[model samples]
Target: MSGTGFWTPVFDIEKRGDGSILMRQNDPLTDHRPTLADALDHWAETAPDRPFLARRAPGGGDWRRISYGAARAAARAMGASLLTLGLGPDRPLLILSENSLEHALLGLACTCVGIPFAPVSPAYSLVSKDHRKLREIARTLRPGAVNADDPEAFAPALAALAARGRHVISNEDGPGRIGLETLRGGDPAGAEEARAGVGPETIVKYLFTSGSTGAPKAVINTHSMICANQAMVRDCYRFVAERPPVVLDWAPWNHTAGGNKVFYLVMTNGGTFYIDDGRPVSGRFDETLRNLREIACTWYFNVPLGYDLLVEALEGEPALAEMFFRDLGMMFYAGAGMSQITWDRLRAVARRTAGREVLLATGLGATETAPFALACTEVQERAGNVGVPARGLTLKLVPQGGKLEARLKGPTITPGYKGDPAKTAEAFDEEGFYKLGDALRPADPEDFTKGFFFDGRMAENFKLTSGTWVPVGAVRAALVDAMGGLVRDAVIVGENAPELGALLILSEAGAAMAPEAREAALAERLAAAARAATGSASRVRRALVLTEPPSFERGEVTEKGSLNQRQMRGNNAEAIMTLYDGGPGVLTF
Candidate 1:
């Protein structure tokens, strides 16, 4: 049944002093429009000279910016470049690159025309050694142009495809490859009119899922879906004409959160987008710190691990904290839930620096729905409540068998994956709604308007020997949240074991300082957290903090730096047994 056309319920979202529900209002925007093309057209006509992208080199000197006019011109030129290569709407562009100004330009260009561009993980280009998955992707979509962010290896990766000969373009050119700069130099771009009459329903980009657990699927996105979501997100954040926010972000554009959501949010609001070349891991994070030292940004977004490291560094230097908080409006976070310890530390530091609590908000989203479906916006808190759905989004949690499953219907939802109608057909329900596959029971289901926490994926959740179904994602998140800096991530034991156990990996920094002593201290803290855990269902009764790194040559760990859980367990079966049976470092009673 069609529930309602549009409804925003104001239910009790917060808890009162007496632990009762407190009324929190949620009113959807009255002027919700659903198209990215219209938003850009409006912004271009209204404020053409406003800086849309502000970026700098690694050393953090002066910022380079591109205005609305320049952005539009570059997009058209790139679109012209796509057509010059004999590409069309039928065949999508395969972009394998990192987050950069050029990547953003090409993405916007694809939207200008009806040509769909799919940006795959750079791991597929440089990291993934197997090449099986990358080869499979090439087989599915015989890409016309492969734009490798890297100049050296990217061209070769694209050339690995059989029919991909003579159509590969590299942003960099050294030995023998076509350069992106070379393409933009020869043409005045007379193909601007060819891109006219493009509408919201046009397929803009195809984003592949990370597939940490299994095979990746290309999530198709359209202009209408992203633009509509962008409108609601921009309005909710109050990014409007009068006062524009300055953003300092370094998240990979391959992910929809950074590419579609934040990118469009900045463009739609006419704000300045300062692109950071730094990454969360490696020595690049130092570049982020150096960048923060120079410019005063209104908004900053990063992952929880990145935030923790930055905060640790900020505690030592007050001058750095001064530069950070000088004109900062809010510090946004995403990717993973902020642990309670991390959240508390952030809140304390924010209060110390800002003289009040500066909000650290996050959201729940996927690559499928323009990377933003739910967020914590209206009110500020450290807890994990991803707030209500956006203006046009309609969420329904249907109980199938015994678990509550979440389904969504809106313009922001993707039409389907590129050239895979069978998989796409399996993704939706009978009512034509996109099946999210994950379950979502209201935080307090009695008062449904309070919003919902993401229950575990239906496929991932498995039943214990006692016949009790375990929500893996929620339990994993909760345990990791409790462990904080001591454990980087975990492998939930007790799949067939008698009791719950964990294979813990210490944070690199935490492990570096007096490794043995730190492990001892962490063992005690972990024991305490386990003892304090709510129930036996998820509690990690014993844990083993892994000291040695998983070998890359053995394929136990991927080049993307993620552990293959099943492989890891098999590789370290003795340690898993030790942790399971409470053998050596079992500090908990």
Candidate 2:
């Protein structure tokens, strides 16, 4: 499919004398709203009765919606209540809950009243036994107020924060807890006064990075950064401005992809957002499938695994496929590299169902770039091409260890990490570009505008015994794709060894097979992959299947399900040694 009406794909590239390259879009960013409050006010006045947010009703018969005017009123009253409780830029609100109507309202209230808020991942509270990360986050922010939708479910986490003299708010009334209803009854005039103080530079929120390596850093997000990102989004996906986008997304708001990108994408475009109460997991994915059958999203986003599951459903159920692709303008995947099998399946299913090709694309960005820096809008035969930099941003590709390391400077970039001046200083280079720590390879070396492929994470790639650098990201993706359906993900090992090895995480299909059959299947697949590999640096000579999955609490896996390669290797040192030793259960290629 051509990005004829969707994208204005043009770029200006420059090669520097210092062996670096700079790239940016030819056009400039158009004017955008100074603050999110302005967007809420505009939509409320113009489209009073339009549904702005929706969620599954308690019993799940129908969707309960909140209109633009009603949402604005609720936000104003909540903002007034927040101010009365002494919440502001310095002492922000800390939210520990999943995506819900109340969560959305509380976030809007904070933006409206110039009170910076941080919505943390629910896993830190619900999944962890020790709540170590939660305690670290509380210490970092020193928030004055905290909110958890269900006080009973989050009682332990709330107690941990309350011990530090933080105020607790919940939907249910309890001893020493503020009820959500009480916040909704505050005077709107107080909120209106607070809104006047908010400007472009005012802090909107703090989106914490995924603490894959260590404690998560709080990335400061300002009103200008988010608004400029939406402007760039509109310029690239121009069809969104033609009509209000209808999105049903399940990605947690704690991350930038959903928090800043998808959330504001709906709000800034005057679109309707359906908070999906489903996840891309075994038991939870059925809810997502049910929701997709009912809501035809104009713009859809998901991880590669979700697309793999979705393609199976779309191919089997024609009615569900019809509803899904009915008004679908585009499909986007990120967080991991998608397999060519899944990519081809999605395109074929869409063509068979819709009778026309739908744009399937991906991008590359970080939490600091508001997560929309480089987006691919053009048609492609396979996945892995993250297109050029967006408008209003300058991408600097600096030479680093045989790869072009990506660094960016732009209005959409976060100013710095909260309360960590030293770490923040290390984040940017002397030229004032935020170091992304990712390496890129141009798709077409002769034509820079063709876009670039994610080479690998600079920190993850390592040298082999022969001094050849092994790109772990590429090798891992290739291995998983080659394994067909036997493995879900692979952790590449052999940092200083003669060749590469992998610790495999089995897929559902692999786990269901008999022990001997599974081993044979793995050996056959690994041999085939090794034969097809380009060189020793890319080949996997041996493999061992991990009996246990990556633990969230152990920091082996991120909330987005991307494995932390370093953490995984460190946690499984014994397994690596066993694989190299050709021990029992290790498949030798």
Candidate 3:
């Protein structure tokens, strides 16, 4: 096949009974279970009537249900349709869609038929006007089929590839585009009957990183990698080892947390996954709240923003409090650093509802590692320390300056970046371990039993005018913890400037506190707290309360919910300039 294409695994996937597909290979990791296809197939056999895909619509209503049996049928049908197109293991199909029940089914279809599918971010399509990232994605995937579910935006790009041997599938009705309705209606029975053999190492999907450095790189995820990461995280947390887990989350499928961790965790255990259609914006969160009332999740996960909003809803509603507590396994928060004030409320609610506080743990993972690298199982009164490496994973601390950088070696880890050899080289060490780029020495050099505290990224720290290095993550976490929940998050300013200062976002509830009442108010209390916590060169002198939330589409926040420091300064140039000009103690305008 040409000189040498990308690395394709020698192993393959085979369809098991019901909806699952079993892997037919042996490896260093856990004895191979079902392929992604096998995992979903198992759900169909064991729990056919269970609601596998529970989704809330755009408007507020009860959950629209898709059972395990139906999901398996859809995947088989979609897989068959994929085969009828003549695409195989060699050539891949790329899905350009957002997180939806349909997206999940489409992905399963790829797994069933051995076609690699990728769910791209809406930013690279509908939200992104220029399509700069979308253009690069096309160059990277060179897909045989461009699934343009959003043709109002993707039609032009699909048209550009019209002669280049790329097929275009549209949303409803677009000229020269095969509508998804039509594709769905077309006899999936043919494709199901056509299915003969599939593989475990068969690449089921590709997800591109936001790629702040340059062009985003495509992460190649095989069925084995996803299954391994899913199994590892599940075993550590023991979220639902007894029975299948019932989860409610809305994190995008384009990222590892949503795509591999949440999706696979639900599928592997034969759990019911309810996609929270609510976004953290106006009018969207209601749908998420409705789902919470309808079905209590044994496992719950959300970014800090989603949790912050949900806590408010839970506090006000008695029914929600009862639903949240009863049969809830554990509540987990990730995607960004969490604040203590928000952390406290979660526990308070847990205690009131369950008569005992449930564990509110934070973990770490990236799109490259298939998402679950480090996580916390037990409930902690404090924040910031994510537990040790997952089972079957090895960690190393390479000394870099005053800190030791974290790197990992594991079967769950991706082989390398797809289609980019230069990135592949830089991502790994001489021994071929993936360099995590997080500069945090293990708390115990002798034993990782104590676990690792995130020191900061090796590259994130910067020097002041006094030539002192400021560890941003250490300072950021400490400052937030110090202010309690009043000051939610702060962006450490002053790289070669006079002093360290912050541009802070206030808690939604905290921000509502009366500023005139200085003693008990959030702003005044936080200022006092921030003043007391400052070290010699690291203290935040003046904090300008953030009037606006960071925008994802505006590039102020990364896909992982981390603030893009470089982009922040550029986008808020006026705000940064005001800090130097000395307008007010807090900049609201």
Candidate 4:
């Protein structure tokens, strides 16, 4: 309602009088193509010279670009080669690499020919000391071909696999490796045949879940699910088609946020994507800052930690801030909830720089929902407002254990998890609605149209020894905001204990302070926050600063930079005990 002409907010909400609400977009869903490859072909013919993707050369040389026509031609050649390699649904392509122009092109090539591909997180292969998870994933996928950017980087992982007959491809040739140029050197004879076989039900890719509770399961992504989700996105944010979206992103393609949402959002709209080399972490964020100074993104997205760092940079650098918001229409945060403090600072910085307010929004979705189910387009200053259900999606809120559990049934929802029929059977309800396991409450209790605030994950919320249920998501966001810039994230502990506790990940500001000063400052902030608390659940009694970062291999932190609350608590049981044991370095309220 308070935004510019780029987008007009619209939603319809109906109350059933039984504490349940029905919400949908006012705009009707547009008829999208059956597959993503069709959209690429359309753009290639209509705007052959428009830039589709761009990335800096290795070691930060010149910017490399691939136009729509060039990308289409390369994809066709790659698809033809894959067909000859006998890669299809049963024997698919497995990609293990970071985000690159080649990664994007190869991913598109797989889709063009209906060749199912799974871009597994490079962490499983590159970071872990033992490639157990990667082996399990490759075994489950039974891939006919494996691809990586650098064969030397993934040499150990590649060696662990049973690679007698599998085709190995990389940018540069190595032992038993076929170069990328050679792979795509084949003619486009089989390209048309592959594209003609694709339909709405054709399998496009396999997106793996975080596996916070267990082994990661591959969620089947169909062409219909992805295409329909983009239609809903276009209906919600109308400015995308008006001008080609320019996006700078670093989120890994293994996750749906970057791989499906941002990647396809650009492709489906005939937009340009710049692969961001900088991440939101402390050491890597400088690349993001440098990119923001050069490219004025039409739409921007980052996790909460990234936003916090950007806010600090924007407060100091006026030139960078101006370039960042020059043509920006909306700023979005996901992979986790954004704190109110970060949200306020971002809006203030944008207003100061752009001389007009920009929409700061967040949405609710999961890997199973093609990663887009609800989006908030309303103008609000606070965080935690995940907007109404997307167009063409049916959202059913059921009351469970004193919370509203969200479920989805639509074309965008995944059919089920791959290679896990038992888990799939347990995933849906009797009505065939996929249980999302997240809880939500109405943003405005009296007005159902206002949207909903994320409560907490059903499995993450725990009961104290006093029989009080603690909403981890709400409490963690409140505590982090209350602590100001001291804490980046937290894991709320005290399951079956008397009171709540937290393991805090220090922010950049907090980490910059001297050891003694940091401890004293944290104590002061903890006391202030505890004084302002109103309930036992909101009141964090004891806190411990995490000395070590969460490990990706341990499942404590997901590749998307989201903390796995349950996994974190379970992995650090000794730390929790030490805090409760009245140990040193533990601040008590």
Give me the candidate number with maximum lDDT: 2
Best by TM-score: 2
RMSD for all candidates, in order, please: 5.4, 1.1, 8.8, 1.7
Q: lDDT winner between 1 and 4, please give it.
A: 4
- For model 3, how does the per-residue alpha-carbon lDDT over 1-589 read when each residue is reduced to its tens digit? 0001111112233343432222222223445474777777777988899888877655655568899998888777767766777666655777777777777777777787788887887666666666677778777777777776677766655554454667676566567666655656646666654344566577778888887657888887877788888777655656466678889888888888888888888888888888877776547788778778878888888888777788889889978989987988677777667777778888898899888767777777777788888765545666666766676666666656666677777777787777998898899988777887786645556545545678877666777888787788888877777765666567878778777777777765467777654224545555565567646356776667667888766667765467766566667777777886787655321
- For 1-589, candidate 1 gives per-residue lDDT tens digits of 0011112345324443533232333555445444565566566677889888877854565778888777777777777777777766767788887777777777777777667788776767676666666676776677777777666566456656547343666675546556767656534354556567576677777787655444567787877778778766664565333467677888777778788877777777778888987777767789888888886776788887788778876787777888888777667787665677877877777789879656577667677777677765533444566666666676655675357776666777888876688988998888777777877656666765566676766766665667666676677677777765766776666666556767777677566768678767777777777778777667767777776776543445543344555556667888877776667764443
Whole-model alpha-carbon lDDT for candidate 4: 0.87
**Lowest lDDT 10-residue stretch of candidate 2:** 1-10
User: Which parts of model 2 have CA positions greater than 4 angstroms off?
Assistant: none
User: How well does candidate 3 match the true structure, expressed as C-alpha RMSD?
Assistant: 8.8
Per-residue C-alpha lDDT of model 2 across residues 1-589, encoded as one tens digit per residue: 1275566756788999999999987888889998889999999999999999999988676999999999999999999999999888888999999999999999999999999999999998899888888888888999989999888899889877765557898887788889889999999999887899999999989988877777889999999999999998998898888899999999999999999889999999999999988888888899999999999999999998889889999999999999999999999999999989999999999999999999999999988998899988888998899988888999999999889999999999889999899989999999999999999999999987888999999999999999999888999989999998889999999988998999999988899999999888898999999999989999999999998999988989877788989889999999999999989888887
CA lDDT for candidate 2: 0.91
**Candidate 1: TM-score?**
0.87
Candidate 3 residue runs with Cα over 4 Å from true position: 1-29, 57-62, 153-163, 171-174, 185-197, 441-447, 483-488, 506-530, 545-549, 570-574, 581-589
For residues 1-589, could you state the per-residue lDDT of candidate 4 as single tens digits? 3245333546676667766655665766779988999999999999999999999888976779999999999999988888888898898889998899888888988999989999989988889888878887877788999998898899898987756668887987677887778867968877898889989999999988866566789999999999999988887777887888999999899899999999999999999999999998878999899888899999998998899889999999999998999999899889888888878888999888888879899999999999988888878868989987887777878887788888888889999988999989988988898899999988987775678899999999999898888899998988888887788889999999999999999887888899999998889988888888888887899999989999998989987678999999999999999999989789999
* Angstrom error at residue 248, model 2: 0.5
Who is ahead in lDDT, 1 or 3? 3
List candidate 1 stretches off by more than 4 Å.
1-38, 58-61, 162-166, 172-176, 185-189, 239-242, 378-382, 400-403, 513-516, 547-578, 581-589
Residue pairs with clashing backbones, model 4: none
Report clash pairs, candidate 1: 200-224
